[model samples]
Target: MSEKLRDQLVGAWKLHSYVEIPVDGSEPFYPMGEKPMGIIMYTPDGYMSAQLMKPGRAPFAVNDFYEGTLEEYKAAGSTYIAYTGPFKVNEQNRTLTHSMFISLFPNWMGQTQPRVVSIEGDVLTLGTASPISSKGKTVNSKLVWHRAQPE
Candidate 1:
């Protein structure tokens, strides 16, 4: 991978939109709702982390994380997606693969998934290379992100 492209990606990005287009000619679904909130960060050293959540999710009845009821826990889990690990860039194909060391979704743990990547100005678009099961159907996800301003 070219160092220049990698350098361009080493920062935080804010989620702008996320949509899943089903292969079976179904309507696109929004996993995190229309106005989802998320942050994805890539480090120059190759580490990366992503956290996405549905906006306005209800708070658990209990304040403590472990004290939530089963329903609350389920709601929390179902409305969020997170993972972190090392990332690799394929310069030839203009792709990026995230090798998950940890993930909120257990099935993704230890798996490496490639995403087709494109950058236009400050926006970065990532599209799934393969269909993934979401909400009971196989679909390809397309996510757009804007570069985050430093805090």
Candidate 2:
């Protein structure tokens, strides 16, 4: 059954869409614009890393990573999401947990977050298990991914 499956996820996935649905009756918000770009990879040895970003982000005036101006830094920071660490799958419950040891979002650092997983065809959808605070509003995040094809 799908719930008792995990091997299907051991590969690279490319982001298709990301939407944050607010519980307060407001319209859904796109954290990285309508068409975001990202990649998520789950290694065979229980490790995973995800990096997402708004497409067409402007390059900083300075080429250095740590030398960008305040505005540049803020723009880059707000437009991207990233995290990496160990991952565990609960085949019985049909859920996956991402233990964030390195996260761009401060609140997620050293945290383990659960995702409700659904894979249909070549698409994989992972969603937050519960509503979480984001930009001062309660929202649930849903991120869709497509299995990356071998080059």
Candidate 3:
């Protein structure tokens, strides 16, 4: 990992936006809601983990399947997901791969996802390409992160 990337990612980040685009080039917005939150912390020991939260209220709006309507799932309050695993930066590929040993994202369980990240000052944009292309189209999810302020 380049020192540059390390310096930019060492701290924590807060979620700003989350969007899932369909293979048909249609835009579907997913809500992190008013208090959607996330935290990414990188350690000097080369360990990394991230946690993301979505405000609990209505269905995801886009995919009704992810709507955890069960009383238990709803009483769970705001839905929170997290992953703790190994991470690597391939400067040559301009990508970062996170091999999540643990993930709450059902689809991401035991999956390693490579995310392309762009950083500018305190803003970071994170996204990944879709594996299943449809009609020569592609889908992707993008989430914006803002660097946390130092206490």
- TM-score: which candidate is best? 1
Summed backbone clashes in each candidate are 0, 0, 0
Worst-scoring 10-residue span by lDDT in model 1: 1-10
lDDT of every predicted structure (CA atoms)? 0.92, 0.91, 0.70
TM-score of each: 0.96, 0.94, 0.73
Expressed as tens digits, the lDDT of each residue in 71-148 for candidate 3 is: 646544336668888877776666777788877756677788888788888998888745433224466777788988
Indicate whether candidate 1 or candidate 2 has the larger lDDT: 1
Q: List the residue pairs that clash in candidate 3.
A: none
Best by lDDT: 1
Q: So what's the TM-score on candidate 3?
A: 0.73
Off by over 4 Å in 2: 1-4
* Cα-lDDT of candidate 3: 0.70
The TM-score, computed over Cα atoms with residue i paired to residue i, of candidate 2 is: 0.94
Q: Rank candidates by TM-score, best first.
A: 1, 2, 3
- Stretches > 4 Å off in candidate 3: 1-3, 56-70, 74-78, 131-138
Predicted candidate 2 versus true structure: per-residue lDDT over 91-128, tens digit per residue: 77778999999999898999999998898878999999
Q: How far in Å is the alpha carbon of 67 misplaced in model 3?
A: 21
